[model samples]
Target: MNPFYFVFGRSANMVLILIFFFCPVSPSYGYDPLDPKGNITIKWDLLQSNSDTNDVKVSLLNFQLYRHIEQPGWKLGWEWLGKEVIWSIQGAEATEQGNCSRFKGGQLPHCCENKPLIVDLLPGAPYNIQTSNCCKGGVLSSMIQDPTKYAAVFQMNIRAGGAADSDFDMPQNFSLGVPGYTCAKPVQVAPSKYSSDGGRRWTQALGTWNVTCIYSQYQASTSPKCCVSLSAFYNDSIVHCPKCSCSCQGLPGSKCVKFGETPSLLQQVKDPNQEPPSIVRCTQHMCPIRVHWHVKQSYKEYWRVKITVNNLNILKNYSGWNLVALHPNLKSLTQVFSFNYHPLNQYGHINDSGMFWGVEYYNDMLLQEGEVGNVQSEMLLHKDEGIFSFREGWVFPRRILFNGDECVMPPPDDYPRLPKNTARAASFTLSIIFSPLFMLLIIFAC
Candidate 1:
């Protein structure tokens, strides 16, 4: 019954309660700082079934706001709980069919592998085999860009080992087949409803399972894929992208050709079937994509800016490429030439971000390492005098994102600054040396 012990016990209890209330919750493994709520959801719904087989519809929904699945699209794989085989598949097909020699006298199953890898069918698949939202070559657009194209669905006839419902098993070890994506085991979810006859009728699945997958960029690539450069009409010095923004030369996979050696390197014999490696023109910043932002001109009330996205890699062409810029002046955008623009007002009352992409069928496809390897666009924004100023790099973008991945920007101090008095002194000194050289050259020629 000591008073000190009683006070200590109360103090410890209060400390425990504070800790419980103030401790931060751990974020999920797939959490992204840019797209915090981004994740891919895979759903499997049992449609119909016979004694030995069940028809199930598998769907992939991209819930990410800006991230998307692009070229060489998504590949889905899963381990079968039972001796389940794909008797038939629609909207998609198995990459390979393993040996089914044990089955003697009937039609062969579509795939007999214990772990089957499935891929979406390409465009122009036969009508009989196509399902709704099934074939897009696995390309799923981001929800913010195009909501209608963000989901993919495929149905398959699963041949089970037993006849009863309990004997039927769920799939395990689901894989998205794309690196950096980790999928969790399937979990039972409420049945997904379907609409028929134009929303006049509705049907619910008998059973449904869902698998959630998150992406970590570090797991997907060793380095960033893009970088940003800055230039302004007022400053003579162009601030280039940071050195080794994506990667450095002499690294194992960083193979690049010298500026003049690109043609010879391209002519060299290479295996056609093998995937092409990243062969970019030698530069300090070894990034595949370089987005250049230039403050072109200033008018009485409107300022002009030019954005040019260059594809440095010799083999990769970006299809449906998009760029996002976060700048306060974007809200006052008056004109955008040669590219489509969409405002990304992520936070309410904040309209500082805008997405830009090439106009379709014109410059939509940013080609690789040639005359047409880049896409350029111009923007005119009405300046807000209260906050608009060319000093202290205020005209430059706050952030630039290429293809949803944030590009490494030059340091704030490295940004192109307005011409100072010292710049004119250096120019005069250069003129003095070049003037003597010009006279000497004329005398020698005469």
Candidate 2:
């Protein structure tokens, strides 16, 4: 019996060795099958403004899961495992303004109060799930703090055949929690007359101000009384008078009165000789008139006469004198003549007692080397003087004053010819010429 037992044992051992060698078991671990009837329970804390109140509604969108596989060197593989899960917590009721409610189909039902969704996973595969409300295109996604980290907690369960596998545990539960972005209702404060400052402050009367009489100084019998007097009158309308039998209103003999007449409007003045002033030619009599100097761009100097004249004179002599130095853009700079005597002298020179007028040139005078533009004293009289005069709506340059140097006169062809006046010949003359050197001095100083 011992020999037969030994033979049987040896045969059995040989058969086992053959099986091990021929089968060549792969280097792998086996996972027990999952229970088909098992359910995964998931719970998440509802997001709230201040505390863990389940009154706020929150939801997840674009939910997804990934599985980590060892065979492929622990690479991450995406799985649409969210479709397998069902929601458990619908959300809380909406009572406050902009709050979400469970009665509304779109509202999120409360957690634990609502059913949770189950996610399915592949057997033996390590998996993770994530959810995002970003695709919902609302304030929820942007307002959530650290949404990416919060989304990493969704879990998944797998059913492999019928048995449960210890290796097939559910992924950690996560959430893209609801964001507290509801705006609070704005409260408005109305303006109050009793505020600390003199101005009104906001009160229950909205933004409108309640007008109240703020007594000021009195001007006439109808003017409002002074604040002190008004205060006395407000307290007591009647008071005893010291001298007269008739009682003086509140605080006897007080200059202040309850009301007074309104101030009168200012009166407007008019002048009879207010004709539009006209431009007149600089006559020989007006030769020594006062001149004011100014500078211009491109190294040029300008001169003008300052005077005020009646508007009628300006209209009558519109074409006689050329208001040269005034800039076209600076109309205010134009000189006007007047009949009244001016206290200030022209360039510090006293003027003769008479109704004086001024004439100006239209263009700036250019300066050359060794040329002095300003004259300390008036120039000597000359024949055929190049004078600018206005007449019958026409401007005439009677003569061109030329010095020894190339006078740089305006091109003869460019000169406009008056219908009834002939172009005067250029003449040599001495006059107070404007110099461009002065312009350079002004430019450098500035």
Candidate 3:
């Protein structure tokens, strides 16, 4: 090398090293508290299945858990919010498959993403943030496969209490996240279903789709927005990924990530057998259209939904609101009923994708806060698929307000009973039982 060039290169290397030492990495943390629109919370619960002293399986309830990885090694970055704007991690790190490396090398050290999960965790949150509400990730293939290894890796450090030994009472916050070896990238649902023929017809291939965990927030519509056609403009109405922008994971290596994921979720509804329809609850801040579902009949085929406006300030006059109901288990929607007060105004029809959305008919249709109104719809079920297969028999889309606000609904709980012929599955139930003594390491089991 030329003397001058060699000296410059060495100096550059030194500067980089110095930068690494003096500067620390920065990862995103929480959403911006000052966003003008409004703030929403994500909810979830932990579900565990116990098998034996050596085996325990974990899953999630309503809320979702996601993982993001920091770029390995030090890199040059600028200071933002008093911390260097570079990816970094503490504690132990799970290596992920296809997390920015080649064919043979970066085989998932264990757990995390291909792209940003969902438009963004929060509407305005940045990429590379510390996603709390997260626990272990990466497919525990070895651990899940071998009881011996499972005991070794997970229980080795955990000291189960015995009658003679000290008991360990550790308070832990149980959470959920995809395992890495599985590299199951996060899934984001389309905000609202789309129809090209002016809500008259819809094709699954034409409308909604899925995306990875760290997907970018829809710039035009924050809460799953939809457009009728390419020419139609989108309002800041729903958080959605436009048809043109939807992406698939496993793209780096050019692998195919299939779409049309039918996620089974529980439903929140009441019984149909009662004389008067049973009342369901709206557990969250589903403002403009705070809804409580009811079962009008016991046939397991038909149900009623009562829609309301909880906050007056948040929802004033929702004149042209189109109520949409999504249930992954629904096979077909035969009819949609009108609200009790304005009977004619609340009728809608089902589209091709099994999404039922009805336009409010009343010209000046409005739902005032503290006022409860309802729209009912009829549905047919695939007896085997809807009742016995999924958790709660429903998986509705995240609601959106007429004014384009995203409404967070509570997890499904109050659901209609399974059709008389079928019963809930005990498939997940296992036989082996473990002593309560081993429960001491519940925290470490994560």
- Return the lDDT, model 3, position 402: 26
**lDDT by residue (tens digit), candidate 2, 380-428:** 1111123322222112121111110001122233333224332332122
- Candidates 1 and 2 compared: the better one by lDDT is 1
Which residue segments of model 1 deviate by more than 4 Å? Answer: 1-30, 162-166, 262-275, 421-446
Model 2 accuracy (lDDT, Cα): 0.21
lDDT of 3 by residue, 325-386 (tens): 33433334444444211111112442212222334353224443333443334433333333
Q: Which stretches of candidate 3 lie over 4 Å from their true place?
A: 1-288, 300-311, 339-364, 370-405, 412-446
Q: What is the TM-score of each candidate against the true structure?
A: 0.84, 0.13, 0.25
- After superposition, candidate 2 runs with Cα above 4 Å error: 18-446
lDDT values for all models? 0.86, 0.21, 0.27
lDDT of 1: 0.86
RMSD of each: 11.0, 44.2, 32.4
lDDT-better candidate, 2 vs 3: 3
lDDT of 2 at 185: 21
